[model samples]
Target: MGQIDGWEINCDMGEGFGRWKMGPDEELMKHVDVANVACGFHAGDPSTMVRTVRLAKQHGIRVGAHPGMPDLLGFGRRRMAIAPEDMYAAVLYQVGALSGILAAEGMPLNHVKPHGELYFFVQRDAAIRDAVLRAVRTFNVPIYGLPTPQMVADCERVGVELIPEFYTDIDYDSRGALVPVAESVPVSPQMIRDRILMIAITGQARSATGTTVDIPLGMGGFSICIHSDLPGALENAKAARAAVNEVKKGIRISIY
Candidate 1:
């Protein structure tokens, strides 16, 4: 809850709508430690949310709320100008929905993570970030997010724990910005495993321009993220899990 030791693998799940689905969530659940569950705004319906939480419980994994903008048609990827009040309401609405679902399943809502464009919006806008943090404070749970300078400060200001995350299947650009994960392109599991080791051992990574970016693994730990929608996602998750285990035994595999 407050501060945990070591790293954990978290994957987005239950991103399906009704009978339609996006990723192999059932199989993917076996490889990750936590599930960022959709709360009906981006991709999940009420029934889908229940099924997703049950899947996490089946795997004996933790559950968290993944709140996104009200852009279901765009899958919550489209950016929008939202008022701070609106952001607060949307976060609480979605998080509360999933919290109730977790209650029925007898599992506590472990954390809150903004989805898609909302994730960036909170990072770039202080007002919206404050709004979202206020809503999260109600549940008194940690947040899975990037540890931007302002974000780290704000989490401390609000008395909430911030679990910084790094991506195993995504890359950074020359400017140190994350190159978005392309769902259609296939990334080799070997490459993904190398990335996991590279960052886990050094706490840093090289961007496309060869810029060294420091990843904030606070308290000597991190929450590693692997997207479920990427091609060869299950293999990637397995590779990442294996690489994490290797790191646990004081083994450092460098991609250099």
Candidate 2:
């Protein structure tokens, strides 16, 4: 087994709008280091944002913005063709709203991680990537996602912090990058635990095709992500925490 000196767990929270709620935010918060609060675009309302921010504060976790395409019907998972200008504006507006919520709660906005389709779109489209990166730079907060070569270069050129992330609750491809989920399936706590151990300790993951993929976790500059909307989110978080703690060997794990 490989060794990890330090790591942090992050989760998406506050994804409900109006009367509808999603995920066990409270329980998951206890096991994570950051909360990616959904803005009003994809999911979450003004009140939900504030409440989620408050919850993050209470749990002593950092708060980040989870901006998505305004596709609430599809939970922001559906890809939408968006103009560069519009994408920039949407990201800016959503991030600003969440920043306001954090400011009101006397908390700082730690990062900006795009949610759902918007997240993947930025990686593949240069125009959208530039727009989104430009918008994120305005806030001067780190951006969280996969550590692609282009992403690294863009973030460096734009002068924004880049925190490469690994998705433990989802499957990866031969490249060790997450493959989009087609359904909300429950990932068992044991499965999650095994995945975290492999990622944090070895800096490697098994892909869907049974290929072993390499990640940069061993190089430090990486983080773990757990999808709150996924089935068994709370259990997954617990399992991850336990696995990290075991690796830590009584030493405190620092949340970057």
Candidate 3:
């Protein structure tokens, strides 16, 4: 796909295991363009994955594989010290599994986005970033994450598309890294909408410390991510989608 002139709304979906569920996925799917389906490592089971894909298909939303470290107990948010080789295999394992399921449903894997700790880890570690980028390249699809310089360099080296992402449900520090969820204050839907508009219009994010952090919206435009695990997720997704669409209408932005 070419660079989107407009923005894309992507929500982290299918993050539940077994009978227990998280987020208002059905409602959120109606508003987002892409669904980052969890691939059995962090929180999704086989049934959840299949169901989420089907739901996305029913809503005409694209599906992406959301791979994460094998930290189910920590919900894949806790950082771990795994070897690069192990990280590579783990990523490939998850992406392949999700692709197979999508194939069965006659759907193509649109992209890959690392979940939680794995996403942040790749930002600072060159070895792991290379390993993860290599695995994503094997799938021949775009990878989504924060646009750190190291990640951009690794993507260029591996010849894969890297989609920049901004989180509407979390806080960021001056360095553009996400503030630990435990320490961040709650954000309302209006606040989330404001943040989305800031990135789409100004290409900057207001950090928690009230510092203006630079946010590069790459040539592929950018994606706004809303965590489905947050309270009132449905309202947040609606607010974010509204903000992106309104901006596109005014500026003639085209969404991919």
Candidate 4:
């Protein structure tokens, strides 16, 4: 296999607030290529956000904003029905906050990847997607999203770059939607490696319902996301990267 095929290992970091901390961000950072620093809405305060961005830069990893709804209690994973304008404002607030921090640190945001429920919502809801698109349009950064044709079309309509991202730590349904992580889906390191290999080799995935769904892999443009909050996330990411490397040596896997 040629090293031209590259994968990006990204993680959600800086999700702590006040005195409460979440996950081993520093340890996880050593294994990931990109760090999606959470804006204050869902989790993280100004101090945390700034620190996370600085740390990512020090580690030579690409930094991006991990925007979410204003649902701190649910950790921004609970679905919230809101107007398009509100959605746009919320995204702008989050992304702008991170962008400022990045600018102050002399680092630029490489992309934007919505967190938790907001991610799934935008994937299926055109109105919500448009809101996010509008907010991100003000900035010159790529939008990381699901690799669906509709999403690509939406990005094109907004004249923004779209980096279709896939998750190696999550399951997909027959319809190609992410199987909610709350559904107790079994995800192990081996299974994750298998899924990545399947996508890299076949450009598709066998869904939980035993149906083969077309995935936009090997299309010369796509990215992979591995969440840091999941159990054994670091190990799984290392394994996935090792597998990708074994199949194709000297390939540079970017984190953002």
Give the TM-score comparing model 3 with the true structure, all chains together: 0.94
lDDT of 4 at 25: 85
lDDT of 4 by residue, 138-244 (tens): 88788887867788889899977777777777777887777877763667888777777777666777787878787765356566777777788778878777766
lDDT of 3 at 255: 27
Task: Please identify model 1 stretches exceeding 4 Å from their true place.
Answer: 182-186
Each prediction's RMSD over C-alphas, in Å, is 1.9, 4.6, 3.3, 4.5
> TM-score: which is higher, 1 or 4?
1
TM-score of each model, in listed order: 0.94, 0.92, 0.94, 0.91
How does candidate 4 fare on TM-score?
0.91
In candidate 4, the residue pairs with backbone N, CA or C atoms under 3 Å apart (3 or more residues apart, or in different chains) clash, namely 33-255, 34-255
- Give the C-alpha miss distance for residue 173 in model 1, angstroms: 2.9
Model 4, 85: alpha-carbon shift in Å?
A: 0.5
Q: Which stretches of candidate 4 lie over 4 Å from their true place?
A: 1-5, 250-256
Worst-scoring 10-residue span by lDDT in model 3: 247-256
- Tens-digit per-residue lDDT, 1-256, candidate 2: 1111247888999998898999999889889888899999889999999989998898888888999999989999898889999999999999999988888889888899999889899889989999999999999888987888888888898888788888888788887666887732347888787887776555788788878898764366567888898878898899888877876674433321
Candidate 2: residue 143 Cα off by (Å): 0.1
Question: Which digits, one per residue and each the tens of the lDDT, describe model 3 over residues 63-83?
Answer: 999999898899998989999
